[model samples]
Target: MPKKRQYQHLKSFKPIAPVSPALSSSSSRGSDSNAPAKGVNELLSGLRRSAAGSSSASSPHLLANGPSVHPDLRSILQIPDTPPPAPRRPVRTRFDASGRRLPAGPPPPRSWVTTRGQDVDLSHRMRGLKLKDAPSDHNALPGAYLPGRGSLIDRVLRAIASDWEFQRAYQQYHLYFLPNHLKPALLRHIGISGGGVTLADLKLILLPPTDLYEQGELEADSHTTNEVSYLDLSRSLGRSIRLRDVTNFLVPPAPQVHDTHLEDSWDAAVDATPSPPRALLPNLTHLSLALSPDDAEGGSWRHLLDFASKTSHITHLSLAYWPDPCLAPRAQTSKVTTPQGNKIYYGGTNFYSHSLDHDWSEALLVLRKLSRCFYELEYLDLTGCGSWFKALMLETEHDHVDWAVHWGKVTDLRLYAGFPRQEDMAAAEQVAFAEVMETAALVERHIRHMRAGKGRFINVERDRPAT
Candidate 1:
């Protein structure tokens, strides 16, 4: 430093200061490193400020100004743009010989094809095969697959015929109320049995008149009245009519006089009707006539008995009568005092021996005639005939000629003992009378059996006397 170092053109330089050893070292190292760091920091701060300003601006404006564009390029870009033509495909010509332009042939059919991989020839297949043309076998044997002859019609016809025949046969043995339309069929097929047909199978028959005197739709005078009109429709029967059928015919006690008189007139009307032809029922085996005790005195019983006697072929007979003790004496005592009275008595008693004062002598004559006519008699039911039946039994003086001996073949007998009112001594007398009649019937049966050379077993049934 003593020797001045010639320095060329060191103009306006600041003077260097003296440094301590520590200070010198520090000045060289620290100041040199700090100078570069300070410059780098200032440069980095300026770059950070510029980057922050640009980031805060709107993105659209920034992008717009980001790239430069020439005016010529802008005008060229603004020109009306036209899109390029679409790619062209090859044109197919119809005149082409190979037919390439025609729509691709239909896709190959999807079918299961057996290939030659199997143990058979595929190329020459069906070469020698021919479909056979043969006639079908259509001729069939009788009653083959075709349905067998149907039996429906045949079965139905048979059923109808069988049912009709059964119905017809059943009607011949029982009385019935039948419809007017069907009566002809019933009559045409009346069975061999002599008795009347049953009430069943004649459901369609007309009901009897409720009021005999009233002129109603079902009156006897009605045009519709016929054979079916006689059926008693007020009752419904189960199987067969029994003894009750006879008893039920009696008129109830109410309006007794009116009903009794009307019934008497009805009986007369029935008797007045002309008899049917003899051949109407050639097999007629039985006949039954029922009368009330009150009607016996009015001379109705005599007429009924006479009618029964005239229709002679009744083999099995049943006569039911209700007795009136009050009138019995009058009938027994009445005699022909004058010519007119003689005629009346004769007509009433039918020319029977009337000298005997008995209630049933006149009626007994008619029964005797019936017995003589029906020689093959098998059964007799003289129920409710009163003391006359007793007298018939008691008058057994003539062994073979008596009434019982006349109908000696009668095996079945039903004697209904009629008892009159028995108040005080009357009841006892009535019982005595019934017992006498019962005894007579038993004795007659016994005598008939003894004559026939057959053992007689008598069965007696007795009940309290009924009016």
Candidate 2:
């Protein structure tokens, strides 16, 4: 009776081979009326005894390897010793001076020197008004409230504008085109040292004389600040804007031309460029200056003028010149003399020959001086530069037969031939064809490139790609 009780409990052990519900039910149904039915306890006990005998016989072999574990336990416990390491931090695109990572956005626009402890944004607290959207009030006082028009808003502006700290903040921020009377005050604040404006590019559009006359404010505080139209004060704003016969606009103080190792190829870097000009902007990266009427060779860019009688204005002047020093020394500095015997020096891969109404050679010459000191220039916009650009191409083709003015690292060039109410521009196909041949030199000089990426070109016309 004791042995029977012990075996009865053995029936509780799980089966070695599983009897599925389907098989169990089918077997039960078929066995009825055919054979004696086995009781659940008897079947389970029999299975348990058979499994025990088999396991005992195999026990020595199984123990030789290790105690045999249930298949379920094997899967649960066995894991790869070296699972793939936790995923690493993603790669970084850029870092700040401190070497910490910077999230992607337009970089803060200040040189290390100009960026102070606070690096405050001047316009952020300017009563939530955008300068561009501010309504024009001719009747209002220039920098403060007009004597009798003392509205609440005017009073507020007077208070803010009068605050010396606020004015300095505004100048530091490069605010532009305020009341005509306010310009001199701001310029005084900006002083000889440019308003801590650290812009990457300075684009100046020399509006035609016609545009200046219409502004009517041509003489607005012109005597005090020497600024032309409202836009000329953009020296306080961008890095760029329009110039309307403004002789002494508030440009940054002239800086000594720093030696540019402006290297593109290893060879150019080894051979440094010489006679760099005094740059107005030591920190500016790119500077674009354009004259409005490109075809106005008969205007300020007059090619027929007596070189001796008239001083050459730079805006209408174009000459082929190699900015890269490696090749500059090799170029024989060519000189052209005016009737007055004053030597007009134009050599070293620079050429210019376009008729103009006024001599723009002087104005454009300023850019040549600026280019030498411009560090890290990426884009050069010569659109509306017309003949001037042609002149540059001509000069480039002379020495560096394979390239056209690949200064430092200019990559994207925007060239457009446009004049308001002027004759329609050339057909797209025509411009495309010309551009293909013109840009060939750039393609060839790209120096072992599988694809042309030295610089990209954005042409005029609505459908043309801005690549």
Candidate 3:
């Protein structure tokens, strides 16, 4: 055991004040309390003043000669003749990192704190799948993305190693449909040194539906640079373009290019000149359009029709879920009263009456115009088109199309209507004999008219078998 240290003497010890020897000697002769203290104070003030006035390099004899401070007191009250210099901290040198001060070498291994004992880089592990501009396979389209690398055997081995690891590896690659930022780059790539892709030889183009795509921050700059137009497509097609799905892709280009200078005068001239009013797709053969009655009024459909005029050589046409053009009302009319005091005019199919023999005049008129537009049409598919097939078959008063005269080259036609059960049809016919009988008679006549031409194939499908 260690012994405790002693501090007992410190408790009773008395401190002594320094007094001048002369004053002390005089005080010893006749003891006076205040006089000795007053003398010592005077002497101390005189020494301090004299020491401050004298130079630092002066001899030590000046202080000895000046005040008769006793040797014992002098040692005790030893103030330095000159004040010491102010203390300074040492400066650490810093090298400029912007300009390399040291020889180039490999970067030091990342700290344990940074790596956290993980094999994969922290940033790489944290990163999510991002859409890439170019595909891993150069042969694939701009939007195509293949997740895994290597052959089937390699992939299978990887899958066997770890199911989660395989899934994570597969999730790294992503594809976005025709992003706004990528459009300009894709066009340049195709027009310039694009490998395996050529404008002249490019045949099929399948664009994603509007709902499936990511437009991605289409600001003024991006819009100007990346906006793909109908004109651009036409030029890129170069007479070989077919099977184009222009559902959401056909947009008119920006009128003016901002913040750019033209080096080539020919390019400037081309921009200045307006596009000629003619069929945009003169050689387009296979056309597919999915339009609703609401979109029929839009300028997009009109612009498309301008491209696909009578001059267009479209053969195969597919109208998926196309609206009934005849049922669409062109204009809204105000309520009107007849002279007989009965309200007659409002809008739409309400204008026609049951008393008057019903003729599908509006639908037939529209259909006739469309047939004339696509006069070279051979095959037509109207799948999921509501009441359009019925309208096509129904008789009209005027502007009737002779199936032989209009679609001379027609070989195949596919139509889809609801599957009305044979028993239900029979029951409906019995209940509404007059209406069903008339419709049945007209359907028989139209079927005969359509099938009159040899080598023509027409197949109408239902949701399910009517039997």
Candidate 4:
């Protein structure tokens, strides 16, 4: 029985149920008291009433928020209705002098004043040579005929009459003795005879034979020792000839006989007669002497220098000899007096004492004397001389270290065959050659104020490197 009671007590029980909304709503509808509607239609009607109330209450709020819908929209609305116009610049004027303009008037023409302080027609003068008459075959005929059959004597006499014409014609027609073929003809044409002609005139003699003489060929000797066989043709030509041609004959080895006996014989033949009074070539601008090795042995250069001292106007001089030091004796004395009253004294040992110490000094004395006496020298060609000259001229140890200073005015120099062997065609030697060229250029540019073509060393063949 207890088990049965316990089982019935343990059994589950259901709770009381709540009333349904539909039933409540039906009750409310039926009662019609002051309660809200509960059906779908009433609910809809209540929502509509609430919506209408909400709309009425929020109408003012919507209007207040409507104006500020978005920040971008407000900025767009506030933008200016019209844009601003661009600025303008002022215009420039034409006639103002402040602005850059072309020159007002034409420029002055190029001009230069003449030496005579006159406004000469420079352009007209610069204009090329005007043809007096068109150069025709007829115009050249007279010049062509004059060379062969014209009377040269008559022309010379006529030229002598007019000094200006003579000077101009002399400068133009006083031909140099450059052609070998013309030498004998000229010498023959100008007969050798004793006249009032001085050696100065003889210096002007343009005997073509002298050019031949330079080429180691001379006409057969017509003179003998006892009598004057060959005429003094040089004197005759000197009277009428210009001295310019003598420069060519003054080249090295003139009267090129080597034998002293023969030289003496030739000298005697030329001046056989004991003439009372004869003028030496005082205006001799150029002179060359070829001394033999034998002649240089007995201090013969002193005698030669003595003879040279006589020629007061010898401006350019060249002394060349075969490779023989003895040919140019180096002698110095404390007191050396010439027959012409020119006295020289050596303060030191004589140059030709056969001592190496005084070699250069002695050579310098000779060169100094020559340069001092011949101040008008323009060119000095020392091609074949021995080292004695160079030792004196180039050595810097002596007091007269600047041996070539006197020759500063000389414009042209020809040094061939005798340059130091080591200096031949070397880069270092180029400086020495350049120095020489510089000196020449300075003279030509400043002193002479003229341009001239200078010779340069040209290698005949490529120099091969030593193995």
Candidate 5:
């Protein structure tokens, strides 16, 4: 090593003052008479003796080794035998991410660390599958997911990747149920477009159970737009989640449900409450029901139509093919086995609605019932609806329909003229247009009556060629 700077040039070491007062007094009294005197100033004065003669500090023979005390050293003091002082350390400085030096300050508050983030998972809200092995199809909805078996999502992700790749893959993975736990994450992943999600995107979302989800909070665009959430609750029953629970988060357009067979849910929705309106979705304004005309007269189908007739808040109504399949020409019809093992037929015993002429299907009767039930309806969407213009004109002569009431409040009436095959389309189109013109005349007549010849109150729209 190099030369020790001023560290080696010290007088010979001596013992410190004794800790025991009695021993110290006795030692001092004895050292004066027997041993050589060891004083502090004498040691220092002697060590500096050579230093005073040298013109420079680079002297090897800096200290003298002897017991002789300096006689001229007055003001002597006791020097304790201890190691030299430790070298001083440089002060540390902190800097921000932008390389700006931070000033000294106290540590951050505990709340800053403990506060929950947007990504903080609500363990209780998420329900995971209990598969013992990896599933064949990761995207497929699990047949069943039991509780208290640990998080299925986490277990599966860990099995496929290491810790570094874990969370990244989780963001990319497709979950079965749209968990309320990841709403913010989902919105971020999908991104915001327009002001909110359009009707097209609403069909793509996998709605979670009714109990766990909140409607208003789940609005994709954070605005009360017509972003309808459609759910098929026909397969789920007896679970903790009920259909009514789906209404908790409803926005302007209520969530659509496909549970046509459930009569109690239908009754519950329309039945009036004593105080706070017993309707599941109190703010519900739009509803689309999938119906089939073939069901028994006194069954759930009738009950659903009845319930729908009494509905008041729903201003926009759409008759759709949700609960049942579209009425397309087929060779054979499907059969359903009931709970009591009784097999109900589709084409054999059921009344199938199919015709080449202007014979309206029995299902179209729902439209008349809807018009009667929802007298104050503002919008009636029949874009995806089946045909009934011809039947409406034909039935008026037999049944006395209050035409003013049906077409009076209606501002937007979309009519779908479903034509038959290519061979008869020319003839069918001519008939359909004629019937449409006839229907328009009637709507105009009712409007004129309601307005007392002031102005028109309706827009009759037929199938326009898709761009």
Candidate 6:
């Protein structure tokens, strides 16, 4: 059962009326103090409405149309008008895992490659620029082909001209016209079986007359024959041939005399014969001769001397005689006695010997004649000439032979032959051989002493090749 007590306190409570609002101290003390004061009920009711609107705006559906908050309260509450920026995602990339950039469009097609040894095989493929052929329907233009064709032609022509092997063969073995009669011998001598000869080889093996007028006159007077003549040489080997080297190739045999008296006087007459006044091969420079003393009845040397005397432009001269005392002395030299008038003898086994003094004097005469001819000689190689060359140098040292008239540009002089035969010399002959070699060594020393301070490339040596 429910108790109905506690009505005693409610019976005493009576209804009370609302009170008016009190004025502020500033307003009450103002000159408009008599103005009416607002009731507190109106202020209380306005505040109640604002509180109720705030609570309703908290709902998500009402937030879009919510009432504006007070300016002072909005700043305190830190309300944001704009929404937060959307979270940023990583930028998409076009690069692969290996860091190489992928293509923006479709991948290119693979290219087929061929190698020289493969003969146009298409097994290998790669990516590159493609070469396309021109259309066959287009008519060829002259100037259009000229640019590419001319450039290619120019490259080929330049390569052909600059090729060393081709140029050397052309310059060294270029063909020339030759006379039919003399062509066989000349070709055989030059080791060529061809009908013609080269300018380089012809100059060394043939001799042309010094004067063109004399050649022309000789040609007009003479009839065609089977012999080689100065006119034949001039006609075949032109003046364009430059005579640089005069070796043993062109040495002619001594003139033959059928008459007995002429044969008796031939030696003196040939030695006294003067050299030609006019020179041959004005640009002739090198003279290399290796001959025996008994060649062509001992008159072959005269031809070499005559050839040398005509040229004053010789810069390199090498004269070598066979059978020196240090070389094959026993075969060439003998102590056998012979008649005074009969100096040469065809003894047993084709052996001949004159007095050693006579042989020395003959070699001296050749050296003297050659010394008087050349002035521009730079290299003098007297190797294998025996001790006679040393005697000539000794004469020059003693003022008997002219030194300044012959030598000025001689920077290289080779005297002694580099051979091991000296070690095999008998003790009895070795003493004399050493003495003779020492005399030759003095010449090399004297040259070095004189040309010491001139700052030249002095290559004066006794034994060449460092023997």
Reference-based TM-score of each model: 0.32, 0.25, 0.35, 0.27, 0.32, 0.33
Candidate 3 lDDT, 93-132, residue by residue in tens: 3444586464455444679535665646654444322113
How does each model score on lDDT? 0.41, 0.37, 0.44, 0.39, 0.41, 0.44
Model 5: lDDT to the true structure: 0.41
* Model 6 CA deviation exceeding 4 Å by range: 1-281, 292-299, 322-365, 396-399, 421-436, 448-458, 464-467
lDDT digits (tens) for residues 8-116 of candidate 5: 6787578766589888898888887897776998989987986776633333332222233444442264432333344556556587689998768754677764554
Structure candidate 5, residue pairs in collision = 215-249, 216-249
- Show where candidate 1 strays beyond 4 Å: 1-279, 292-306, 322-364, 396-405, 418-426, 449-467
Clashes of each: 9, 39, 0, 5, 2, 0
Give candidate 2 misplaced runs (Cα > 4 Å).
1-288, 294-375, 388-408, 420-467
Q: Local error of candidate 2 at 120, Å?
A: 40
Candidate 6 structure quality by residue, lDDT tens digits, 62-114: 55455667667878998754333445666667787999998686534543223
| Residues 28-83 of candidate 1: C-alpha lDDT, one tens digit per residue | 89888876555788889999988988885634445454555666786888843233
- In lDDT terms, how accurate is model 1? 0.41
Model 2: per-residue Cα lDDT at residue 12: 59
lDDT of 2 by residue, 58-145 (tens): 6654444454566676679983232233455677569778989887966566775365533445445454454333323431112232
Alpha-carbon lDDT of model 6? 0.44
Please tell me which predicted candidate would have the highest TM-score against the true structure: 3
Question: What TM-score should be assigned to candidate 6?
Answer: 0.33
lDDT of 4: 0.39
When sorted by lDDT, best at the front, the candidate numbers are 3, 6, 5, 1, 4, 2
Q: Which residue pairs collide in model 6, if any?
A: none
Please give the lDDT score at residue 313 for candidate 1.
Answer: 50
